[model samples]
Target: MSEKKNEGNSVSRRSFLRNGALAAAGFMIVPRHVLGRGFVAPSDRLRVAAVGVGGKGYGDITSFAEGRADIAFLCDVDKRRAAKAITTFPKAKFYTDYREMFEKERKNFDAVSVSTPDHQHAVAAMAAMQLGKHVYVQKPLTHDIYEARKLTEAAKKYKVVTQMGNQGASGDGVRQLMEWYNAGLIGDVHTVYVWTDRPVWPQGVAWPQTNATIPAELNWDLWLGTAPKKNFVDNLVPFNWRGWWDYGTGALGDMGCHLIEPPFRVLGLGYPSSVEASVGSVYVGEFNRGYFPESCPPSSHVTMKFPVKGGKEVTMHWMDGGIQPERPEELGPNEMMGDGGNGVIFVGTKGKMMCGTYGINPRLLPTSRNAEVNVPQTIARVPEGHYLQWVNAAIAGYNSKEAKSLSSPFDIAGPLTESILMGNLAIRSYDYREAKIDGKGYNYPGRYIKLLWDGPNMKITNFDPANQFVKRTYREGWSLGV
Candidate 1:
């Protein structure tokens, strides 16, 4: 495919400064004031280097480009997946290994956009921040709680603007939900129910016993990055990685950020005080329960309790794998509950409110109430949307008002991610087992227990074994570099 140019917008002079001969000449340039803020000379645009520039990554960079960002570099382990982006951004330099890209092109770009799998999010985003570049990372921020904490801290230490890829954080729906909650319309939300019909991919399945041939265009080792070394398997590349614990965080990790974020924002939630879970199991033979510790359960219902100020506690319920809470009575029998596939419900002392994923279509219960009530919009709306929010923030400099006001910066994203991953920890611990004394079968001790959490310490006070999931040891060679 031929590279297509944007209509009415020519490539900026900054592109020439960064990608043209001037950059090769090692010219040390001054700051962005030469053209002044009003004129927006091509040289003044934010230069971006995107890692994992394919799939969702490609979409991310495309948004940045559309936001007037200069896509200066593209890196992905699979050329097959990155083909479109390679053609689309022909002016951008390409690389297969991000480490090499960072080392060689660090000075060429002003910010980094990371859209890799959950496992690699922290490493790639951390590397960008370490180089003093603002970053936009996809959600659920990191694979583990520890990585989220580290990335959150790094953003402050590096003094770089940051935003997570959960675009809903910047949507008007959440702000509306927030305004209503603050107005006491819902009257002190005591509980929240967030559910999703996800795992649209397989889960609770055994790992492939046979290794398949790696794709010609892929660098298998590089794609494996921080994950444990494993033989290439069929269909694992572009998507199915979600089923396995090694690559994805199952349905909860996949949808929790979108579903849970609304409640977090509305309630000003932080780490949970305790977590408990119940998971649906897959059966093998007539009498045998299939136990694939390497995979997430086929379905699960997790409950987490958060303690707010004034000694009030709120309970949040997370349901996945097609599970959903009972329809709110206020909803008409014919009415849809949260766009049908995913939704969130906040139950308060006075009434209930709900929204679909990304907090879209938020409505107060008894549907009629939506028409009668009007809450002032106290929060600012992100008309530019999530992608541009990050780009604009980056262009505004680290300490600028825009940077400080990002909808999902690390300070918020990190803890939100950690809180969501906590449910995964409970789920994983639920599957935890030990050998029976008689050696007949394993004894599942982690099941049916509410694991007490020490959020500040990031530990399961009641279950020592579950703590292992809090911070996983990386495969050799890859490190968060904390």
Candidate 2:
């Protein structure tokens, strides 16, 4: 007890700070357990700073807080939207721009969680990663394929722990499906059908005229981030941005991670070899198609081909905007298909299996079989769940002894997200056209050709025009830097 012992033998905050010459000079100040109650071990807790603390952002940041990580800072472009989170973490320093927050609070946080609009995810997450901070980002990993590729590469180079907010990837249900599939329950899955009733917002139309005034509590310019400049429009903030190509990735982007991750994980699926799609269109008053380039089509069905698991090639079908595939024959007349609105189905050589959103309620085809069949539990269940999985992994650090297990780390999630977005590429390219060689009028060329993808190079080999979408042009001030 020669170490200037306090009455209770616990290190006080004042004592810890005064004794922190070691910490100030780069050393472990003290073990958390030895420091006693109310004192989080320097090595135990993750200091987290979150950007976009509203809507889904609120839930994401709160998960880390409740999981025992410290919420050291909060940043958001919309103050009014962020009110709930601000109230929730009153002591957290707040900023309007994530860049400013990162610049100032870089030393204060161990990790960053991003829940901004799709376009903002990569810019914020990559900036934090460049600083060597671990990150947990809301899914579809980035707004474009190029951003996804870069972030994936940076995560390894920076050596930071990472995870995506596709909580279902950490769910027991998907693992159960994997176990069942591995046990030869469903045989080799040759086709997967994932469908959703989304666009819950507007799509398949012209972008709204932007005469409406921007809300005073919202920073319109900062909120625009890497997106092209546009006048503020009502109903576009908070949620409806999902419909716009510049800001959101539409219904497919919104739900694809949850619905598609299982198939990718269970089958060890990688990039697609080809992609094709048919989209629902708005005709207005005439039978002729009304092409609204700015907004996502109301509905779409995209099919992608992937080399099968040591066998034949496989196909994955993605449907959105309330469209769904036909019910399997093994499912009874009364049995609900894929939890009603959203679901996934795998048709294999032996039989079929399926699940609902977030991979909940996984069941084999023929309702009676689910109850009768039991498979060995193989994958470890994440204690606490998805939010805590990253919290624990981050706290464990990249090289921790216990070995943090992140279900959706960027290494896995980045490629999975790229595959999901490839569906969107096909959908967007479907509308591309060229002047007819006959010199009379326009002919839809991309409409007829199947986009042959060279996954390794991230390009469409057959169509040069469709290659433009692999990356996007950022506004003058913003770029996804190395």
Candidate 3:
């Protein structure tokens, strides 16, 4: 994992000095002079710090490193994880605490990649943006609906470049799907069935016994951050935290953003009218147990109702924990679902379209009848790489043309996030009782409640009391804002 330097192509001293001065003056610094002739002169060579240098964070840093951007710093709560990345960029400074890292090295970096767990994503990303640094945060955007809305607002106020870590957004498949939908290929899509076998890594189950002691190289308290302090349990660290309410968003929050992106974007589906969730009781007594200490909700079924921008309505069903929709007879007998843990199934008036998790080769159903169905040829195709696109965007100061065309912006990401989060809220509401309560205290369960949304205010006109659930109170000194 030795640092790979592009020797013989190093920046000239004069060019480096000029670029440094421009950066110090808060002016843009382009890569043209540093990379010299023959190499593409990107608008700028960003100096980046990676805040979570393990798991997805490691991949993100290397991608930025490959783009010739300087890895100014690497931060992680786990020393072992941090060490693995330090070996890859030996020159980059390392720290176990990102806040401390930001405090000391904030001026040295132009951007940061936040690839931490769902819970810490908003805090880390907002901190970097507040410091006038651009950010690329991982998928699902935030742990709750309120955080997602805040991050979108913060990005606008900061006037900094921003990209969500839904790498699939940069895939050609997604772009093609958009084209198909725009062309009415799916023919007035009215329903969507999105699902995953996630926590495939086991969730909603009994917690495994902790036999191993906390590693000395790990700073467990710093890792917990604003999360209620807890002793280090072996199963909770690394990846299993996805099942706990404290660390992650269970299954729906984990995969919903990616799985539901296509349908939300293509149909222009706005806010939902209502949401309801059903889950097995394993960790807590109620579905929305008002936050817990040990675990998350068990495997659940969540249904959401979206009132489209137009008069039409759309129903989205989310099922996880080995649950799946009935296979469509339209698919050929010989055809089989590709091996993947996650995907989306769009049910339209005419037919269905299936897009896999990474936005891999999406397929249209009615295999026999639609064998000759025309699919528009894409004008632009994104290269088959995710991390590389982010790196190139960072160095160039703007996203590639293809990246801009294929990805979902805040307009789409925001509503999609809100829709998915409603599923979580629905789960909580289900816990209260079978009777659903409106703002006026009217009880109407098992029926769709017409709730009007004011996205700007993050409010529901008819459900004023429920507004508090949309956002959370940040710990003192850790709040994110303009």
Candidate 4:
């Protein structure tokens, strides 16, 4: 797309509505609520343009299609990865660059589904929202705290429907957890432990010393997107990118959204007031440490404190890379603690409750109480699931009741993602180093310090250097259009 095509068209549908263009046409648009729920005409189905249409992106568009959306456009940097989606959506137009698709096919689609790398999520979603297209972006929402906050504000400013791809937010398990908490089955939650066994890919290692040949079908430069320009490395495409800070947010970003959603909702959590972390180290030689700052650590334990009602605070612990909290004494040793691989535990004043990933298999401590505990279900469930919910909400139009009630809309997911990415900020700061005054070695001042957060302003009150991670400068030719 040319600069003119990219920079032009700043006016959005909301802007047109505000200027009374639709009113001048003498045709009033009725609200979806008045049309009755689930009553979309055959021609009124949501027309979706998908970015990164491969792997998880393929699954995302497929789910949207199953939700009664029309898959109209597909974009990806790697044709090999996108081939399946292309075959499935035989008539859908395909493009390698999302900007090209957005500029050329802007009017052909009503919504955009973004399943790109974490680093690109904010830019792509912001562009779509700028054009007044509803967006469903893959989670941790964005790669940085500033992006999360900006996207959240853009959703409201553009009057667009938005949902983060943390499907657990739509699951019945979370609602049950909320109902139980509201019923006082578990008193005010004071602590939470969310652990995941992730980074099945390599991490805590050095970057490739030698550049590899880039694949012919893959657009390596486009794949880099907002990330820094670098030589294409083998085994870095498709999935392993999750371990790198440049393109991914590590294990915490991979699983934190799913594992953290349950407690975040049940406890009504928001931005964390403070954050700190400790990371596990790997040894290369007998004495040498394998400390690749570019890659996420092999294991990390992050602690974040959030203010709750009555001026009390909730201490939340996030563990990844096979690290887990101590087992609770209320459960049998043989019994599983969160599906054996990933889980969340909430400790309340009166008792404790736990659930596996996606908030599945929620049970009170002493699992036997699950059979006896009876709490009236107050929260509604998402029977159509997450993807379809977004599809239907987008079809329902912006600011409609459906849009207002989405499980993980940016209004909620933004703060949740911001808090989750806060853990990452602390992790990256753990490696902060500066040359000592004597100039012989380095001193790590940011290490072991609890970052005092000014959430509303998006700053670290105590640590200035650590604020660098809050936002990143994109490569040339890319911008969030803040």
User: Which candidate do you rate higher for lDDT, 1 or 4?
Assistant: 4
Candidate 1 has what TM-score?
0.91
Better of 1 and 3 by TM-score: 1
Question: Residue 157 lDDT in model 4?
Answer: 87
lDDT of 3 by residue, 404-456 (tens): 54255444566678787777655544223434433323232322344455655
Q: What tens digits encode model 1's per-residue C-alpha lDDT throughout 383-472? A: 999999888888777788998899999999999999999999988883345634232223446657889999999999988888888988
Worst 10 residues of 3 by lDDT: 1-10
Per residue, candidate 2 scores C-alpha lDDT tens digits across 1-482 of 01122235322223323443223224233677798999867768788899989989999988888877988899999999889988999999999988767665666778889999999999888777777788999999998988898899988887788999999998999999999999999887889999999989999777776579888999998899778889898888889999999999999999999999999999999899999988887766544665566789899999999986566788999999899999999999999999999999999999999999988999999978988998878888876899987888777767764235679988899999899888888877733455332322224466567999998899999987877778888766665654
lDDT: worst 10-residue window of model 1: 1-10
Ranking by lDDT: 4, 1, 2, 3
Model 1 lDDT at residue 464: 87
lDDT of each: 0.85, 0.83, 0.67, 0.86
Which residue window of length 10 is worst by lDDT in model 2? 1-10
> Which pairs in model 3 have colliding backbones?
199-202
Give RMSD to native, each candidate: 7.7, 9.3, 8.8, 4.4
Q: Measured by C-alpha RMSD in angstroms, how accurate is candidate 1?
A: 7.7
Ordered from best to worst TM-score, the candidate numbers read 1, 4, 2, 3
Candidate 2 Cα deviation (angstroms), residue 376: 1.7
TM-score for each candidate, following the candidate numbering: 0.91, 0.90, 0.81, 0.91
What C-alpha lDDT does candidate 2 achieve relative to the native structure? 0.83
